[model samples]
Target chain A: MAKILASSKDAMAHVKSGMTLMVGGFGVCGLPENLVHALAETNVKDITLISNNGSVDNWGNGKLIANKQIVKLFASYIGENSELAEQFISGQIDVELVPQGTLAERIRAGGAGIPAFFTPTGFGTKVAEGKEARNINGKDCILEEALLADVSFVKAHKADKLGNLVFNKTAQNFNPLMATAGKITIVEVEEIVENGELDPDEIHLPSIYVNYIVKGEQYDRRIEKRTYSSATS
Target chain B: MTGVSKKERIAQRLAKELQDGYYVNLGIGIPTLVANYIPDGMDIVLQSENGLLGIGPYPLEKDMDPDLINAGKETISTLPGSVFFNSAESFAMIRGGHVDASFLGAMEVSENGDIANYMIPGKMVKGMGGAMDLVAGSENVIVAMMHTSRDGKSKVLKECSLPLTGLKCVKKIVSDMGVMEVTPNGLVLLETAEGFTIDDVVNATEAKITVSENCLVGTY
Candidate 1:
């Protein structure tokens, strides 16, 4: 059974300076907001953050970047954060811009105990620079090594006391995969049920992947970009 | 000269390439607009790299689900029989070549069919989302973009000066000025927009192009 942390601080305490951390989310959706803020409140520094996007200027992992805690970042997109752009340009932070699919596949490979795999995604581009390539099935593929994290922060819609997680809709995107890729997976969920409460089939991630659970605070669920039209009005 | 906007013209031309029951991915920018012009009753399924299959048009505000977003982070709705999965599995479908076609936005395209859109040396860019994978794995790739930059520079060039997203991977290009095909012979002018002459297009293009005998004014 995963330990249920009493507070966000307690849950975030596992993170330390100079650790490689993976935070699961796409933009703002599915982010462990409480855990992110908790980690920011700490004095940890020289962190390497891996995520889909570095997040927008004031939210998600961006807060950590703003605090100058992140020494390096690995993500597919960082356009939403001007701070990251400045830091990257000024050589304040090191950045590795991986193709989105490759990033996800790398993490998935890590969890599957696969050391490395070949992918056709970045072949023949700057993304393929300094990487090994081979012809697989008449197509060019570059070998990408697996990505593992010291700790992973994942947000879920529901979780059982035993740590089985069920995510909400598209928010489920990276959380389930990140859950598997982390050595210590800490989940923040809206609700926590007793063991066996979550239907086995409904669980998006198994308990074996989760090491800690923290019932998250009420989320604002902020929309990243709000667009309204007459049809909706 | 018609009332159709330039953006709509490009999208309309690109939408014609979609086939019934085809699995397609639309990149951000001009490519994203193709969703609006999808032929009625066509059963094309749109795949978002974020794990959504059967992507539909943007949802109304009242029915908006904050959690349901596209790769662009825009709120969207799903169609009947829509399925969602984790990002890894979604990408598996992409890298496995399950997608039939993908329309992407390019900053520059070379006569040799190379694409450069992910970065511009020093300028701020969103970075390659799944474009590399899309171009590498899709059966066909169509590029949607403006014919030229705001400064009157042609985007269709002899060689892409910017960092390439993929090399010699683009099959077709739908731009504001014309529709072109990338062949071993070089860039071929397939169609020109209405009110635009071959001379007008030729003057703006930096790459050498062969005009097809059947080239006509764009229908859309």
Candidate 2:
């Protein structure tokens, strides 16, 4: 059974300095806002953050970057976060840029107990530099090791008392994979229902992967780029 | 097409290459405009690497959902047959070669079909988001870019001077000047954009291009 926590601050009790943390989101879309805010309030430092993209300067894990809490970052894209880029270029932070697909597969492989896998994604580019490369089936392939974390922070649309989670639309990006990859997974959800209210088949993540559940009090749900069709207007 | 910009013209030409019922992935910038020109009655599906497939047009302001966005992080709508999945599964669709065609913007493209777009050494270091995977896995890879840099330097080069996103992967190129195919020997000039001639394309290209006998002026 997953422990149901009441506040994001309480959820931060399990996090510590110098830990490898995985935060789930694709930019600001599916980020766990309250949890991130609470983590920013703490004095924890030297975090090695892993996510798909570094959100803009004032949002998502960018807040942690602004606070100078993260010492290293592993992400697919950092073009949106100017702060992270400055830090990376100035030798303030260590950055390892991975291909988006390879990042996702590495996380998934971590949770699934796969040690490493060969991928053709970064065969001959800078991404393949100094890696063990082999020609498989007449195609060049590189071996990428699995990634695991000390803790994971995930955001979901709904959760049952049993910790079964249901994500909304594209918000499901990297949450489920990070949930299983963490030693302690803390999930923040918009709503919590009774255990039996959710259908077993509809659960995106099972209770076994979640260690704690927190009801996020408020969500900014900020849109990174708000593009609208002029034709419809 | 008289008042159309070079970027829009490039997109319009690439839209014509899309086949019916094809699953395509479009990169940021000019490639995103290709969505607006998709041929009518064609059942093309747009795949966004952020985990949505069957991407429709940009949403009206009132219908916007912050969580519903394209890989560009712009608010977007989903088609009737759209489906959502996790990042791992979304990429599996890409890395498994399920995407039929991928249209991407590039900084430089070599005569041998190599692409360099993600970074420019110390000046720009925007990481390769999903480009390497898309080029390595998609069935057909097409680059959409300008014929020359702002400084009058040719982008179609004998060898890419920038870091490569993928090697020997690009199958074709649709530029502001013309349409070219990357063959074993070298780049082949297939068609010229409206108002451009073979001499104009040859002058703008850094690599020598062999003009095909069947080359014609593009309709757009």
Candidate 3:
């Protein structure tokens, strides 16, 4: 019940240099913007970030990349961020590119207390290199270890005082999974209701996984890419 | 110089493969273009690995919602009855073999139907998205790509020189110049594009190809 933090500044104080952090988002969707910005204002450095592509250059976890707070990144794709790509090519930062599904399963497995799982996803591919492989059901499967983070930053559509979360639409992509996999989970919600106010069926994440919650401020909801077609409403 | 651009021609042929009620995942590039060519009245449910299913057409300028985007980070509209979940569940549907088909773009495809689309060593290609998972889980894997690189190197090869996305996972390939089915024997030429011939495909292809007796012209 005391999980609510006074502000993002108060919440970001828990982070330190060289910590492994899980940031939740797909593109800019469901990014905990205020929390990320607050972390940027601090002097935290040499952090390893685990997320889905982080964000584009100007928003989401991209801010952390820009601030040079991250030393290594594990993501499915880094196409959108020119800086990240440049840094990767220059070896300024370490990058581990995981297949999207494997990334999700690894984090999920971590929270489930499973050490490793065999998946057919990367068999016979570069992803299978140096990994243990076994024939499962006549398919070559590779072993992928579970991934857990020191802390997680997630965004939610709504949360109750007790920390049950509801996410908006597709924005929920990696938030709930990262929440469970983090040793310390800090969430930013658009709105907060009383504990019993949230419907049980609608709660995407339970409070047990969350250690702190902060109401996000001045949400920009920046679009990663903008396109236009002549067809109108 | 052509009736349709090579990219569009490839996408057009790929669209024809969509079966009604197929739960399909389309990779970026030409695969994403297939949405523009979906047959009218066909109830194809497009799935995005970023956690959207029942995806609709790209919205107009007026209807653009900043929050609504596809896996490619392009703005898109959700069709009626569209459902959004987290990446875990979205991939659960994929790795659980719930998706009927997946259309992906590839750099090269071997005669054995092995696809190498994810990386080009020394060149900083974007990381693999859901291509590996889709190939593993989807019932049918279709590849849409150019027949040749800009340098005129044939992409249909006897073996992939690059990293493989999946081993012998591609069932069919729709390229700028032809549609070929990957068979045990080799690439089976199913359809040739306009102004292109079986001989043309054979000459251009690095992989051995078998011309089907019933090969038809591509409907570009």
Candidate 4:
């Protein structure tokens, strides 16, 4: 029986330096804010932060970049993060720019028990570099390997002591898939209730994939860019 | 076809055609400009192939949330009832014809109304996101493109010389200088932007453009 922790700091106690971590969140929508803050506090260094984008300027994953905890990052979009841009351009961080969708699926496939899937997504571009290409039905597709992380971090809406998670609507983003893919998936929920408290059907993430659970500290849910029209309608 | 300078001129013309309550997927580049001109309180549903369901317009500077973005990987706000999913499920929405309309940017549109915008003529290219699926799945397809290439080559042609992304998928076209619609009969001349004439359009194009009596020049 897994015991529920009170805070992200407790749930993140097991994480160590040099570990490969996969985090969920498209932009910052479903991010694990508390656990991320916990990771930021710890002295762990040289982590491979695998997520959709590097957090932009003092936000979400950007805090990790600021802490210099992540030495290598494997993701699709770094356009949001000026710190990441500086680090990459300066060769201080190693970056692998996977196609956005491909990166998401590779992690999903890794957790789905599928070793690899062929896709036409990155066949001819640099995303196909050093990868195997096969011709199927006269069309070329490159075989991209599944990616697995030593630990996965996810955000959840509510959780029971048994670790069943209920994500609030769009907050379900990458929580469920990353749950299944990581070897040690840590979920930081907004609230934790008693066992059997969460509705069975409403459970976005089952207990089987969750290794640790904690309550989120706070949420600012910062946005990246804002281009607007200032006119009276 | 219109023979005016493209850039923002074409974006403005396409924005005027947008109706309320449409499920729109804006293609990259010029097509993304449609977001800049959405009518106030139109309630259009914007879909992104990257798995967002309820995309509102881009957020303002004070309200910017780094986490919310559209398919172009730029930050965006969401309307109520927005959902998230894996890429597989997102493609299902695109390939399943659930989208009402797709507004795309094209490299060329043939007389037969074929579109070629995914690949370049030479060298390797990036992956096709959901263009093929959008072409086949959307109930309606609208193309917004420039009348001519930078070298003064016509994009509205008799036939597409480039690789086609979708066969006869285009319905209406909005260009810098003109608007055309693919009909059961043939390409119907709709209108041209201000400062362009039929012969000027024909001269700028590499193909033989058809003219109609209802060709009034547009102002937007």
Residue lDDT tens for model 1, B1-220:
4787888889988999999999999998888889888999988999999989998777878877778999888988888999989999989888788999999999999998899988877775668988888887776999999999999999999999988888789999988888889999998888898778877888899998989898887455
lDDT of 3 by residue, A71-178 (tens): 999998888788888888888889888999999999999988999999999898888999999998887799999999999999998999989999987788999999
Residues A1-233, model 1: lDDT tens digits: 79999888998679999999999999898889999989999999999998999898977798999999999898998897898889889999999999989999999999899999998888888888999999978888899999999999999999999899999888988899889999999999999999888888888888999999999876878788775456633
| TM-score of each candidate structure, all chains considered together | 0.97, 0.98, 0.97, 0.71
Worst 10 residues of 2 chain A by lDDT: A224-233
Best by DockQ: 2
Residue ranges of candidate 2 with Cα displaced over 4 Å: A230-233
Candidate 4 Cα misplacement greater than 4 A, ranges = A137-139, A225-233, B1-23, B27-45, B54-88, B95-101, B104-175, B178-192, B197-220
Instruction: Name every residue pair that clashes in candidate 2.
Output: none
Error of 2 at A132 (Å): 0.5
Residue-level lDDT of model 2, residues B47-155, one tens digit each, is 9999999998888888899999999999999989999999999889998999999999999999999999999878888799999899989869999999999999999
Q: How good is the docking of model 2, as DockQ?
A: 0.82
Candidate 3 residue spans exceeding 4 A from truth: A231-233, B1-3
> How well does candidate 2 score on lDDT at residue A41?
94
Worst 10 residues of 1 chain B by lDDT: B211-220
Each candidate's lDDT (Cα)? 0.89, 0.92, 0.88, 0.74
Candidate order by DockQ, decreasing, is 2, 1, 3, 4
In angstroms, give how far residue A184 of model 1 lies from its true place: 0.5
Please provide, for model 4 over A1-233, each residue's C-alpha lDDT reduced to its tens digit, 9 standing for 90 to 100. 34677778887777899999988876677789788878898999999988877866777788999888999988766665778777877779988776555676678799889999886555544556799989878656779888888899988878898888887644565667788888898888778899877778877667998888877888876544355544342
What is the CAPRI rating of model 3's predicted complex?
medium
Cα lDDT, model 2, residue B24: 96
Q: How far is candidate 1 from the true structure (C-alpha RMSD, Å)?
A: 1.4
Complex DockQ, candidate 4: 0.21
